[model samples]
Target: MSSFRVMRCQPLAREAGSVKKPLNHLLVSAFVYAGLGVASGLFYREFTKLNGFPEGAFTQLGLAHTHLLSLGFFPFLILLGLERAFTFSASRKRFGWFLGLYHAGVILTSAMLIVHGCLTVLGLESSAMISGIAGLGHMAITAAIIVLFLALRTAVRGVERPAAVAA
Candidate 1:
C-alpha cells in the first residue's frame, strides 16, 4: 500500500519528459559556479588574515571549490547547452548511465582530491597521498571529458550527416 502511494506520487512519463531543459541546466550551473567562486575568494581572503598568508589549508579548499564550480558544475551546463544546440537525441532520453557516470566521477574525484590536498597542505598527511588523490581525480575527470566529447561528436554527426544528405 505504501509502495503504491509512492508510485502514484511519482511523475507521469509525459510529465517527466518536459522536466529537463538544457538552457535551464546551463543557467543553474552558471549560478552554482559563480556562487562557489565568490565563496572561495572570500574564504581565501579570510584565511590570509588568520595565517598571514593563504595557508595550504585554505588553498586546498579554494582549489576544491574552483574545481567543483568550474569542472563539475560548469561542464555539466556546457554539456547541456551543447546537447540542445546540436539536438542530441540522447539528451531527450531518460537519465542515462553515461550521465550518471560522468557526474559521479566529477563529484567523487573532486571530493577526494580536495580533502587529500587539504590534509597534505596542513601537514596532516603525506605528499604521496595527495599525489595519489590528484592522479585519481585527474583520471576520473579525463574519463568524464572523454564521455562528453564522444556524446557531442555523436550529436554533431547526427545533425551534419542529415544535412549533407539533404544537400
Candidate 2:
C-alpha cells in the first residue's frame, strides 16, 4: 500500500514542477501581447488621423498590428497547447533562453515598426539604422525558433509511451 501510494504520487510531484509555473508565464505573455496588439491598432488609427496621413500612403503601422497579434499573441497561445503535449518545461534552461530571445525580438521589431511608421506619417525619411535594427530583431526571432525546436525535441524524447493494451 505504501509503494502504491508512492507510485501514484510520483507523476503528481513531477507535474508540480514541470507544468504549472511555465503555463502561467505563457498565459500572462499571451494577455500582454493581446493588449499591446490592440493598443498598436488604436495608436495607428489615431496617430495617422492626427497627422492627416493619406488613405493610400504606405506605413508600417498596419503591419505592426498584425505582427503583434500573429507573432506575439498567437504564438504564446499555441505554445500553451504544445506545453500540454510536450511538457516543454522539462528542459527549463532552454525554455528560458527561448522566452528571453523571443520576447526581445518581438519587442524590438514592434518598436521599430512604430518608430518608422510615426516618422513616415510625419513626412520624415527613416534612416538605414532603423532597418538594420529591425533586421537584428528578425535574426533573434529566428534563433529563438531554433532554440524552441531543440527544447521540444528534448521534451518529446523524454516522454514515455504506454505499453500496448491487450487485445
Scored by lDDT, the top model is 2
Candidate 1 whole-model C-alpha lDDT, 0 to 1: 0.56
Residues 1-167, model 1: lDDT tens digits? 22322111111123334546645655675677567656755665664555454444344656666776777566766666565566443544322534555556656666665566445445575567656766766776677566656666666665532222221
> What digit string (tens of lDDT, one per residue) describes model 2 on residues 90-164?
787899999999999999999999999999999999999999999888999999999999998877777766544
Candidates' lDDT values, in order? 0.56, 0.86
Looking at model 2, the pairs that clash are none
Deviation from truth (RMSD, Å), model 1 = 12.8
